[model samples]
Target: MLERIGITNFKAFACQDVDLAAFTLLTGLNSSGKSTVLQSLALLRQSHEAGLLDEADESGGFLLNGELVRLGTGQDVRHESYTEEDPDITLAVVKDEIRYAWRARYGREDDLLGLLEAPSGPTSWATRDLPSLFGHGFQYLKADRIVPDVSYPRSHDAAVRRSFLGARGEHTVNFLRAHQDDTITAKSLQLPEMPSTSLREATDYWMQRLCPGVNIETVGIHGTDTVRLSYGFGSGVSASNRYRPTNVGFGLTYALPIVVACVAAQPGSLILLENPEAHLHPQGQTWLAYLAVAAVSAGAQIVLETHSDHVLNGLRLAVKDGRIPASATAVHFFRRNGQTAEVISPSMGPDGMLSDWPKGFFDEWENSLEQLLD
Candidate 1:
């Protein structure tokens, strides 16, 4: 697992070291650098996947655009008020006790920021010895995911071989179609209310948390390169009736990949999510946090960026209930300071009480209540 992340001259951060745990929640104000943390990891994963961080190679470096992330040119990523005259964007991850840092030169127009120095380590970053960010079970889901569509593309290589659901979860339908019958090995991720522990049934169980009695169907389109996803609503005593994705509301389709991603997580897996609360109702946000907690209990590490107070409370409840330890979780509140973003981390106690609640940290509910009572 990543113990901490060191980022300098990257986007909203000038030089900051963010501590991480099994499950880290990044919260706070809009555009205050919550997303920047996730982007830094995604950047390295995308860069490594492109073979830019190969051991002997020094010319190739961080790829600005790729499957995992599209960060645009160097100027777009470099901090607005970089401290140094020669801007060097650095990203480091501390796994175990070793710190692996990668420095790249800032190019005005170059998409590939050539390496300024090799990744700081005995061996290259991509070697099997180290805890790699680009592992088989890694997933990074952006906030803007696939919407309600008639069909989605089916990529066998992506869904089956690579086991990737795509950054926007574009391949989720195909992935579900392939792994529906696979048994979920994690007990924490299983749904006791459901009849079976298969991926499909378990997934339906979680989606029901978002919308009761909601079900999903994924199948290949005949003679086409795509797959179809439909929703079924369980009514009074009969079998659920099928409906197209368009007919169903957007929330179910939007939250499917999240359920799949959490359930499929195995030990040593790394999942990064941005705004899992997007399009979700209050209750759904809480349930989503439960699913994330379950993933952590199953041995996967999650770094989530969210703005929902409900999501924060759910995680707190998880810690209180002993589903996860308070030490295993970290909550970071980010606030803007001029050109950079500053983070304040509040520790969770076993009773679900936070050690400190910064001024703007999930206090909107109380703030509004105070106004109404006055």
Candidate 2:
């Protein structure tokens, strides 16, 4: 698992280091640099996947626009307050007691920043020695996910060959259709209430938490390169006719990728989620947090970016109930301080109490209640 990430002269941060855990929660207001952290990691994965991180090749460097992220040129990613003395952009990550660092020379209009050869940098290490970010079992789901649609793209390379649900989760329907019956090896992620350990069963079990008695089915639209997702209510003879995705609520469709991601997580996997709580009700948001916690228990690392108090409280409840230990979780509250972004990490205790709650850290409810009481 990734223990820490260090950034220098990157977007929204002049220099900053953020500690990571098995399950990390990043909460902050709009544009306070929350997404920047995820983007930095995604950028690294994108670069390496495109054969740009080959330190031996001087032509290789960071790939700004790619499958995972679409960051602009160096001029767009470089911090505004970078010092002329050290203008190069650097990113480093520590995993399993090894530190991998990279420094890229800045170019105003260039999207592929060139790598600098340094004795201590990753340029000398082999591809196998690099961090696990470049390997399989990595999923990055952006905030803007799929909505209710008649059919979604069905790509054999993306859904079956790579087992990748697109960043926007556009390929989720096809992926589900291909692997619905595969057994979920992670015991912790399998709900006891469900009779089967298949991915389809587990997905339905979790989705039911958001909408009770809902069953899902995915099928390839004959003669077309697309997959259709339909939902039905009830069971056996009482079951309602299968309804197209367009007939269901938006929240159910929007939450499908997240549900599938957590259900299919394996040991040593890295899942980066952005606003899994979007379109979910308070209770459903809490249940989603529980699902993520279960994924962590199965040995996968989850880095969640959310703006829901229900999600936060669900994590606390999980810890309090012994579902997950306090030491395995980390919460960072972020906010802007002038031109740069700042982070405040609150420690979690065994009893699920937080060591500190910053001024704007999920206090809106209390602040409003006090005003109403007065």
Candidate 3:
């Protein structure tokens, strides 16, 4: 697992070091630079996979994005006016017993040269070795788009197993069906309470967890040359089942990726999700948090970016209920000033309690209540 991540001259972060746990929660207001942290890690992993740097690149010396490598510089690094004269990108990671760094500088020739320096400590795993580990080992879910349609063409040559769900989750069903025989899927399906009604059974169970009393069913129909998955929700006592994605509430479709991703992830994978609680009801948001905890227990590391206090509370409850160890989770809040962002980390104790709650944290609700009273 990644123990620590240090970044400089990357997007909104001038310099920041984040200590990571098995499950990490990032919370903050809009544009506070929380997303930058995740983006930096993604870029680092990409660079490593591409072999752009050497062992020496792991140190603090490399220039990043034309600005001197510093923590908390607010200038936009992606601007065209940015010059390589100031080194901009530098990052490091502590994995196992080794400390590795990657640094880069824009050359006079306008080419970027990055070095992946060797580990400074025990030679367990080299920094260059992380790409493959990070490449398939991590999956990121962005919030802007919901899953797209993945109807299979009637052609006889359609690929049997599609690549893992795309960033927008277009291939959600194909991905899940591809992993039906995996150990994780086998175990989850074996649960006695899990309805074995059909392929839709598991999906329905997941949907119900998000919205109580709601039932969902997915049906696959092959017409002449195409295959498609249709959703049906609510039966008898509840709201009528709907057929189209647009017909269901936004919360249901928006939360679908999170549910599908968690259930489909393999052991030892790191899942980075942005706003898994988006469009969710308070109860649904809490249930999503519970799902995240369950994912961690199944051996996947989850890093979530959220704006919901309910989600935070649910994580605390997960700890209290012994679903996850307090030490396994870390919560970081990002506060922005001018161009730079500051990070504050709150620890979760063994008793499932937060060690500190910063002032103004979750203040939106208070502000709204005050306005009403006034």
Give the winner by lDDT. 2
lDDT of 2: 0.90
Off by over 4 Å in 3: 48-86, 107-137, 147-163, 180-192, 196-200, 213-227, 234-242, 370-374
Off by over 4 Å in 2: 117-127
Q: Which wins on TM-score, candidate 1 or candidate 3?
A: 1
Q: What is the C-alpha lDDT of each candidate?
A: 0.89, 0.90, 0.63
Each prediction's TM-score versus the true structure: 0.97, 0.96, 0.77
lDDT of 1 at 7: 94
**What TM-score does model 1 achieve against the real structure?**
0.97
lDDT tens string, model 3, 231-337? 65556666665566555567776777688667655567777788888888899999888878877876777888999999999999989988889989999989876
Ranking by lDDT: 2, 1, 3
Model 3 residue 263 CA deviation (Å) reads 1.4
Q: Tell me which of candidates 1 and 2 scores higher on lDDT.
A: 2
Candidates ranked, most accurate by TM-score first: 1, 2, 3
Candidate 1: count the clashes: 0
lDDT of the structure predicted as candidate 1 = 0.89
